[model samples]
Target chain A: MGEIKTVIVVERNYLMQAGLEAMLMEIPGLMMVKTFTGDEVSLAGHIRKQQADVLILNPLALKEDPIVFLRKLKQIGKMVVFGLMEKETPVNLQSHFSHVLNVSDSKFDLQNKIRSVLHQDTRPGNHNLLSKREVTILKQVVLGLTNQEIADRLFLSIHTVTTHRKNINRKLGIKTVSGLTVYALMNHLVRMEEMGGATK
Target chain B: MLINKNMKLADVIHHDYTLVPVINRFGIHLGFGNFTIQEVCKEHNISTGFFVIILNAFHDPHYFPKERLQSIRLNILIEYLQKAHTDFLEDKIPEIAFLIEKMPGECLDDRKTYLLIRNFFLEYSTELKNHITKEEERVYPYVLKLEEAFLKGETDADIKKQIQDYPISAYEAEHENVEEKLFDLKNIIIKYLPKPKSDKLCFQILREIFSLEKELNEHARIEDLIIVPKVEAMENALKLKGFGNG
Candidate 1:
């Protein structure tokens, strides 16, 4: 099972608020923690106090400037701010929200959108994701090949091999050979039997 | 407010007890009834200004007094940094290892995950020790030598060759790998770990990792902001003195 994320819904309309809370509860990984009116005092503060992982709010319901308010909430930390939108809603929310969900969005659409947003936020920036060449080098590393050995086998220069290793470390967030091996095992880049005495 | 020399020693610790290790590195001990930072430093024979600046820098990440740090003697700065390295190796690393070593026993059903986490940490610590060893064995000695040569306004043929061959800037890249690995180590535990039977132990491991991370960051900041620029200035001075010539 994945990590559970606490979600708070902020909508002033009674029916919409209840509807959002119910739908969010049905999402497997999300726990619908609380509901708040749009103009609640220190709404951001309350969300933080609850340690919410996602805050779904209607921009039309905000008492203060939505842009300023959303930006402040973003500063609080890793929580995702999702805009609950209508057909013709505030334009500025696009910059602030991880994703915008229309009030008329089906329950299935809502779950998919929120799940994808959470998924994307959980990963490090996509720009640093490993390239195919880097992944190849990482596999060689997991197989217990030194830079020179890997370079010789792959018909690349030692300098090029070294650079690839550094990029793999940066992309995967692990540096040592053992750490990379564990990562490969967890990701199933290599089978457990292939590890042999390396991990032992 | 930033801690100053006149603040009571007790108050400083009260504000941030995590700084106790930072204070201890200066050869200062606890058990002062009620002494100001200045009085405490005076009694310990430590430079009060340097002590206060370190305290402030560690307490608040943004409270770097770069000019003041640059003005400090390199040996004094290096000695303080060396002590921090010792604290990490001798104290912090072992303490965290002790906590993590028991985790496998606690989560026997998922022993492989616990063992891998331990292996990951051990690998990180080894890299960290190597990083410190490189600084101590190579970089710090060279920086001290450079400072000595700059102060005397002349360098021998060997020191001069050393300057042109391996400048201070060459050592800067070594820091990045160690820091990035430590970050990945933390993320693995926080995001990727299978559920351990002992939540408390896992939480404690994270707490230690965070403290170690914070101290290492401050250590890097001092080295980058204070030591790097100082050495760069000395290197440039020697170059002006025609030390760059083969």
Candidate 2:
């Protein structure tokens, strides 16, 4: 039992919904938050209001424009989804859902994908996350400067420079100097010619 | 660097020992006298196909086609991915959060900044949940529907109309950028925050973060290398069936 993830099943079929509930019970770390029938009014509104983390859905519930409803969910960016369609429905769900599979996909697989979906290492928010000094350290690191050299050039302590280097790695999600160089290049913090012979 | 059919699982583990975690999920254990790779896997009910693939991958990570990911049924990869996620959400995330929470009490001087570190962790965890939720909720379900459609050789007009506005290409476009706040949280702990009085606590937390980072990197790899490619293939075939966003 880990951090519990609440799941909601949205579908039109009675038997399939019941089957999903039973299957979710057997999967550890995934608790059924609720089950919604396709005919339920304001279905999207209900999903928006729930604290559930994942939604297993059948497109038949929405009838006319399930994709439009999905686009709204995408825009909302709350409560991830699983598209549950009849085993024979022809649709390319790639563009809209993180994962799409037939209603007939094994319970074992449904549970597994749900678990994977819950655990992805998503990007962080508040775009301007790094500091001025940290950015400087990142460029120097990409330029192949050692902590002592960065300290000498910046008039900072060796310990402080080391701390900045560690922070830069954490903030940017990069570990290697080469990786830092790539990040620097991508962000236009440094130019190709400016890269130290380390990359040449 | 030679690989022979006769190579023992015990021999490989003894040589690098670090290989334990790589194959540990398959139930391969230590204390074996002289069992062949196939022999032990058979005893544990592990797929010999998956086990052999792991062995080759360990030998050369660049080994393309990753035989098991290619040769086995798609369901196998899906199952493996599920288990990986379960380990992450249930075990890793909670453990990291717990460790960060312990820091403030352990180091009083570091208390003020420790609060920031813990808060950032909570924020990262929530966003991670959002990321996972988006995929689980929409993306994976879409892929499953695509598979079903492919098998049955048909798709509905409604879905085709919806895909015109939202395509897999768009989702793939946004998946590349790394999680930003996560790095900030780690750095906040490493540089911005005051050091804990107990070096032991600091090391323990760092070790946990490192492992979490490692596990996540692998999870991303499976998605990018194994799962995405499979879905892309199915998507392409669907387009050929005249369901092409027209």
Candidate 3:
């Protein structure tokens, strides 16, 4: 059990909304806040007021072009906006959404996707995501060193450095150097001087 | 984490220590600081006003106020964002390039195929770089120019040629997601491509991609959520004041 992610579903189809709501009941780490079938909430403030962490909806319910509405929702930054699309829309909704659920994906897949999306949702415990070795590697990474450079500096082989780096990223679930640098700085693994992105 | 100037600087570090860079931006240095944030910043010639807004913004991005935009220095925010773009272009992208390049030599995969994959990534990376470059060259300068004009009490009639035709909203409509292409690349490697001859190297690159995704997401967040909103609000205010044509 973790911080239950508050979710609001707004699908244009009642059956679709009901099906999603039924699935939501089985999905752990998520609590339903509101479910609407149609004619609800074109305003960002409605969802913001719910203090929701994720919105699962067909943008048609929002009464605008789905793509444009998704952009507006993203710009609001109130929560993770998950787009519900049927028949594979042409837009790369992934660009605007945390995850886009095609109706074709299985219900099981929906549960899995929701879990993965909420993986970094800042739960109460288990904040320590890196091991000692991983922490050392992360420090090197933030200092703007390549894997090869980090390997030489640590007196480790290039292969070993890559292995450590891989495990570190896997454990922490972060992908970019900038992301790791931010995490490292947050966790005190790296200093301000180490961050390449830091402004002078 | 809640922040107040009177709170021990050391305490804030303990709460979310990643703020080292955040503080350093305000010229606060390491090695001392039983002092209040205000005292330390004062000694270091940092503005408490600037320091406070940034601190609040970092600690709780959701709470960043449109109201604060008018007071916070646009130059500091823009400069910081621009430098971050450079860091991505110069450091992270090339680092990924090197990792991808090394795969061909170490892996048992056909050299030609590996080179092909590497080239594909380089091209995608080139596109991403261009996206960042466009934002820096086109959008940022316009915002800076707008800020300068607003502060000087200039009207739309005065600087219509400068930027009345383009708005920050236009850029937001096409903002980049640092994770998007990398997400495609990762799926290709994991699901579509043949098993990597060196899984460690592959995963290492994936890690870098994740890092880039996270970093870029944060960067985009700062721009999209904070800076863009701030700029747009300023533009709206100036327009309403009969300074600029909407």
Q: Per-residue lDDT for B10-128 in model 3, tens only?
A: 88888877667666655567886488888887888767776776676666533345456445667877876776677677877899899888887675376545654575577668778
Best TM-score goes to which candidate? 1
**Clash totals for all candidate models:** 0, 35, 9
Worst 10 residues of 3 chain A by lDDT: A37-46
Query: On residues A1-200, what C-alpha lDDT tens digit does candidate 1 reach at each position?
Result: 34567788887787787788788777787888666666444456656555567888888788898888887887666567788888676565565676789878788998898878888766544645678888888888888888999999999999899878866764555656777777777666787788776552
lDDT values, one for every candidate: 0.79, 0.65, 0.68
TM-score of each: 0.64, 0.49, 0.52
Better of 2 and 3 by DockQ: 3
**lDDT tens string, model 2, B32-127?**
669877777778877876766655555543343443575555556665656656666777789988887788677536443554456556766776
Error of 1 at A166 (Å): 11
Docking class of 2: incorrect
* Consecutive 10-residue window with the lowest summed lDDT within model 3 chain B: B61-70
Task: Write one digit per residue (lDDT tens) for candidate 1, span B1-246.
Answer: 699998999998988999889989988888986999999999999999999999999987657666798889999999999999999999999999999888877743476676777777887888899989999999999989988988888888877877788888776543435765666777677656666565777788889988998998789768766888788888888888864464
- Most lDDT-accurate candidate: 1
Chain B TM-score for each model? 0.95, 0.77, 0.74
Ten contiguous residues with the weakest lDDT in model 1 chain A: A39-48
